[model samples]
Target chain A: MEVVNRYVATRHHVEGAPTEADFEVREETLRWAPDSGEVLVRNLYVSIDPYQLNRMKRSSASHLAVDGVLPGQRITSYAAGEVVASACAEYAAGDVVAGVLGWEEYTLFKPSPGVLMSKVDAGGGFPLSHHMSVLGTSGMTAYAGLFEVCKPVKKGEKVFVSAASGSVGNLVGQFAKLAGCYVVGCAGTTAKVDLLTDKLGFDAAFNYKEEPDLKSALARHFPDGIDICFENVGGEMLEAALANMSVHGRVALSGAIAEYTGEGRRAVPDLLEMIYKRITVRGFFAWDFLPRFAEFGVVVGGWVRDGKVKVVEDVSHGLDSVPAAFAALFRGQNVGKKLVKLA
Target chain B: MEVVNRYVATRHHVEGAPTEADFEVREETLRWAPDSGEVLVRNLYVSIDPYQLNRMKRSSASHLAVDGVLPGQRITSYAAGEVVASACAEYAAGDVVAGVLGWEEYTLFKPSPGVLMSKVDAGGGFPLSHHMSVLGTSGMTAYAGLFEVCKPVKKGEKVFVSAASGSVGNLVGQFAKLAGCYVVGCAGTTAKVDLLTDKLGFDAAFNYKEEPDLKSALARHFPDGIDICFENVGGEMLEAALANMSVHGRVALSGAIAEYTGEGRRAVPDLLEMIYKRITVRGFFAWDFLPRFAEFGVVVGGWVRDGKVKVVEDVSHGLDSVPAAFAALFRGQNVGKKLVKLA
Candidate 1:
């Protein structure tokens, strides 16, 4: 049988601003074989995250310890795929699995140590794409950052979220609403502001682009000051949030999409505000909470199914559009979880 | 008996830059009689701290339930004094007591419930002024921030300290050194830099003011990145520190002298850096460690006596120099613990 394996690859190193020229398409020859503890997967969906931009950079100093894709190596990420071939007793040929799969037509799934890929029930109510977004790392990130670090959200506490329309922020706002907190969020445009207040149930929302003065906008939105700040955009937004944070406030350092492109570095914030307010700013990695994934999946999946937690995904069709789709996250182009469907 | 009290008071609010006009010399009438559970004390020494300047501001939102100092009230602080008249049986007429005493020649010591004051040792090797600086709040601040929050410092771990020659930073460096960590520090000037490397035994020291690029300087000093950061100066220093911090590094947010004054605020740092680095930035108040003081006192006091922990006090003679002395901390003009002598 002739196997036509199509794969997306990076073209060149991305400097200051990433362009379409940064990525390229490549076709690779495929061999269909299964060794012990291996199951071949037919890639269906791939997650495109802002953090992937860091991996595209040539410098290893800034990038996380993931093996970066070279000019011709197939790009890979957390993807949901169907097991087309299998040698491992754990999987059957037609089983649906979720794991690190390549951004290609088909992938050879080797059973690496410490890898977690499980079969999903075909009868589940949620869509398969939900595994790559809300029921995936994005939701886990919001859950870990909010509940684990900034614990015990008391009723009537003011919560401020930056990048409020993004995948994580949208769910964080919904979770805060469930916690009975007065949620206020900031986004880049009026549409995002509307999404936060109207759809996500945020009590107040502001377009950071429209407001020249971020500190004043925060103060106006939260007169009593923010009790918890789900920080995603770093730069000026973090500064304004710190200035307006109340005593004993918690700032969950989830992401900083603004400075990911290595632009003119934003001004450093006043650290004295943290001390004066007794603020707790903690950084968390979702992978660290993998042990709790089953628990998280049960809880978050139920929330999504019950409509208590809303899941928003900005899906781009075709695997060839993955680079632009990932880059869009930094530009605030994606409203929710940005993903690429490789059907 | 003719009783007279000489006190220091704030004459007016400090403007853009504090001047001698901000304070005035005044002599107030004193009563010789002591009410029930009250003691009359002869003021010996008083602490001059950066937080006092915050109290001098027209508006302040301190977490410690402190109100701003009104126009005419006497400046109060943790001071050491000799009891002259006593109505409490626990204290005698000649007992040397230390508590919150005003910047005056004589102070009325009312027995505040739940307040504990140390009985000064007449034959102690350390100077009495050490109570306000090293042996008091400043020392406690360092001990708490370093040992309590940044715990389990494994041998050969890298530790970085900002404002390394200052009161708390000096002690923090020594404690880290004792724990067998490679300690690096940054100070404002060459002299302070020299003090960090030579006097404090820091593995490396740099003048942050002389280094135009803080991130590059940090990379050069801590090539592998810092494991713990004792943050005293905030703003750009904090940003650079965060960038150079190693995975799972703990940033002990003790003080941020960089933003103490009304100077233009620095840019906010990219919060994503914390997530990528998996850092923990915790703000700590010294009073939170009150329960551990007795245990800490025994350990730190022994260290002081054994010459393992060196204490530095920047003493400004006379209470009249208190405001000017405190202003020096914000300007990075003082090398160590800034204090005022009343006797």
Candidate 2:
């Protein structure tokens, strides 16, 4: 059988802040048999994240994002899709699943054990987009980072979430609130900051762009000291947070969007501060914590039902908007989990 | 009642690498009796270390060495002393003790609850100087950094200890070796490197100063990547170690001697390396792990008896040499534990 698929591909290697002009839509004719445990999937939704920018760059020691998109290659993303054809016992044609699939209309792949792919259970009242956003990789990231990595006991302790209204940061703030912490967040836009406190139950929120001195901004919010920091934008932001961290503070590093386009020479002036404060600055990936995804769903799923947790989606219209939607993330145009819808 | 005691005092605020000129021997006349819960102790041995340098400098956020020595005040250090007089029943005259006291012949102090001061049994058949070296603050620091912080399972995993011949660094290397790890160490001098491999049972040793490219030197030693880093010298050594760190690597941050003498703007070029590898860079103080001192003494004390562990003292004579002894630590003049002897 012959099938035509349209996908977004990088025009060339990306530099600095990515723009819509850097990507072009390409067509591919996929022809394949369902080998042993193989299946053909129709793409439904795809998630855009900062780490993808690492893969689009030239090779270096800091090229951590393993699944890099090559020139003229379909961009790889965390996608939700429907299995159209399968030779696997695990999935049927109509079963909805989430995995690291292509940014295309169709994906031809095999599901081995322990692959990034997972079937999404639709028993929850929320929409499939919610599953792709809050209950998916992003949600799991916030949960694992807060519970497993930061391990904040709360007790009215300060919790600082950078990129406050973004995909993982929003969930982290809500969770911290539930855990009895004095939650605070810093985002790029005033609208995003307002959403953090006004809608997401954050105790305090500030626009980072409004305050050039982040260290002082953090200190004003966290007079006592930050017990935990869910860091998204690294470099100077991280340095400022480190200065305001209390003794034995834990920093769960999820992303470093600031240094992705640069040479990644992170100047942590007070890096030695960790020695005196007994700070734990640990970096983690959500995929590494996928083993507890089911556990996270049961816990966070209840929070969502009780109206304790909030979800936001900055979604694009069609496959054509994928490039612009992804580029919008770098420019801080998207307020939450940036996703593109496809058929 | 007019007995005069000579003590080392900071002449003025110290800047950069400490020198003998920064301190002066000042004489104090004793007059007051031991008040309620107070005692007069004759210090026998004063432990000189790098952390004291922080106290000699001006204050800032990074001045985390809380017990900073004021310009005119006698320097504070972990001391082995004899209780000459006591109003508190907990300590008797002639009682041999180890505690935070002045770098002087006598210290009039009260033992508060949870005080750093404690009585030394000296029942292990080792010299009292050992109580100031391997059995004192330095020993406790090494033990805590290696065990509680690093948590190495060994199984032939690689352990890298920087400043391998210094106070805590020697003990860390020896402990990692005992724990069945392939231990490697780097130091400034070839003699220190020789002492690490030949005397301390390190699997390999390199003079970091001799090797301009530390990353390459570390790569050669840790071909499989470092499992645990008993970090002492930070900056370039830390950067090199981070580059050579394996996935799930643990860095037990003990000190950053390089930053102590210079501006602490530690530029970790590729700090994002932690995210991809899931590395844990934690800073810890030995005081946090003081409760485990007896446990360390039992385990390491046994190692001492069995001749598995060794001690090296770079002792300075008289109270006047204390400044020089402390300055020697910055100069890398001392081979092992730097100490000042006063009788």
Candidate 3:
């Protein structure tokens, strides 16, 4: 059968800031074929993230591992899709699966060693988009950073999150609150600040743009000093967080979207504070916690079902909008999970 | 018996920089009385350190846990002394002990719980002053920061040290070399740079003063980037170190003399780099590694005896010069371990 696959493509090198010129939508023809170990999937939803921007950059370390896209190469992302055909014993036609699928209407998948693809429970109350979002990398990132890395969140322990209204930060704040810790966060705008404090149940939130001094702003909100910091924005926000961290505090480094674009490095605060205060700053990737994925899903899925955890999604329709949705993450346009719908 | 003892006292708070005005010598009358577990000792050598300056500050977190001097309380420090009188079973007359003793000719030690004192090995070949220098807190700080915290220093890894000619930095450089790692270090002066490269056997050494661009200097010296950094001088040095750190690098936070007494905090490079690079930054105190002191002593003592590890001493004679000797650390004076001899 002939398949008309619409996919987002990286058209050219991104200069100062990414614009529409950097990405394009193109039509592709695909033959519906499933080899012995392959499956054909009709795309459902795709995850859009700030990390994808780093992937687009020429000098990024992430790009070093994977070949940089030439003009008209299909943009790749974590996507959830329904299997239309399968010769693989693990899956059959009409089976729902989630893995790294490109921004396309139809994708051909061949089982390679170590490639992750799992069947989704369609009976679950959550939408299929949730598979690529709250139950996906974003949710896992928040879980690993907050619960695993920044462990033993005691009551009244103060926690701070930068990019607090974004996909990962939103869940991190809620998780901290659920653990009975006092959570404070920083976002770019007052609307995000309000959303963090009011909607996300954060103890305090600030618009970093409005705050003249970030260190003073943190001191004002957390008089006792922060016990844990979930760092997202790297440069100035990370410095402020480190400055305001209390004795024996922990900083869980998840992302630094600010510095991913090869900008000249910013100044770091006196790390001697880390020595005097006995801080433990550790960097972790969510994929490292793959062994705990099933365990994490059980806990977070239950929280969502019980309304103890809220899943926020900023979803755009059509595979053509994948580039815009991914770019929106860097611009802070998305309040929570940024996703693109293919069907 | 009447005993007249000379003790160093803080005359007045030093403004801007420390000087002889920061201290004064005074004679105090002592009663020849010994309680059940108390001992009267004559101090022979005292440790003058960069951390002492932090204690001199009015309200620093590094200040003494007990009430700080009222400008007249005798300056306190860790000292190696010979016991003249004792009522404790563990210590007696003529016994050599190392503990927190005042910077004075004589001190009364009331042996409380957890107060440690052991007879010095006269056959150890090294001078008793070695206990106050390499075999004491300074040496232990290096051992702990290198082996304990920045562990698994595999052969062929690159190690970077700031303040490479200082007490702790000097030892760390030697230890990293012995571990078969390519060690590079930065010092303040050309003389220290010579000491690091020529005497201490660092693979690469640079005078940070001459190189205004620390990042470029580091990139030039360590093209592969540093696997471990024994951070002593914090601020811009730390920023440079972070910018040049390899993936999975470990930073052992030891001291930050650069910003110990300052109006503003030091600028740190992007900490998010830690996240992307998956670096591990840990702050540690030497006291925490006291349990492994004997094990460390055996290895280091053997290295020293074989002449594989060289110990450099910047000894300043006379108790009266204690203040000046300590102030030298902040100014990056005295290659190797800085000590004050008072007999």
Best by lDDT: 2
lDDT of 2 by residue, A1-343 (tens): 5579898899998867788888999998977576656788899998988778778876643454475568789877789999888888888989998887878898888777646898888777778888878888889999999999999774887899999888889989999999988899999988999999899999999998999688999999998789999999888888889989998999998887778767444647465578888899888888787779889889888888888888888888789998888777777788889888897
- Model 3 Cα displacement at A138 (Å)? 1.0
Model 1 lDDT per residue over A1-343, tens place: 2257888788876655666677787887666655545677888888877766666678643466466657778877778888888878878889888877877878876776667577776676789989878888888888887778777457988999899899889888888788788888888888888888888788989888899888999999888988998988777778788888888888888877776677744635556566776777877777777788888888888889898887888889997887788767767899888888887
A-chain TM-score of every model: 0.94, 0.95, 0.94
Model 2 alpha-carbon drift over 4 Å, by segment: A34-36, A60-65, A263-265, B32-35, B61-65, B263-265
Candidate lDDT (C-alpha), each: 0.79, 0.84, 0.80
lDDT (Cα, 0-100) at A168 in candidate 1: 87
**lDDT digits (tens) for residues B1-343 of candidate 3:** 4478998887765434577667888999866665546788888888887777666667665642334555777877778889888878777799888878878888887787566555677778888888876788888999999999898457898899999988899999998899898889888888888988888899989888899798899999889888898999887788788888887888888988777767334745554457667777887888878899898878888898899889898888887888788767667778888778888
Docking class of 3: acceptable
- Better by DockQ, candidate 2 or 1: 2
Q: Which ten residues in a row have the lowest lDDT in candidate 3 chain A?
A: A61-70
Best by DockQ: 2
Question: Chain B of model 2: TM-score?
Answer: 0.96
Chain B TM-score per candidate, please: 0.93, 0.96, 0.94
> Could you tell me every candidate's TM-score relative to the true structure?
0.88, 0.97, 0.87
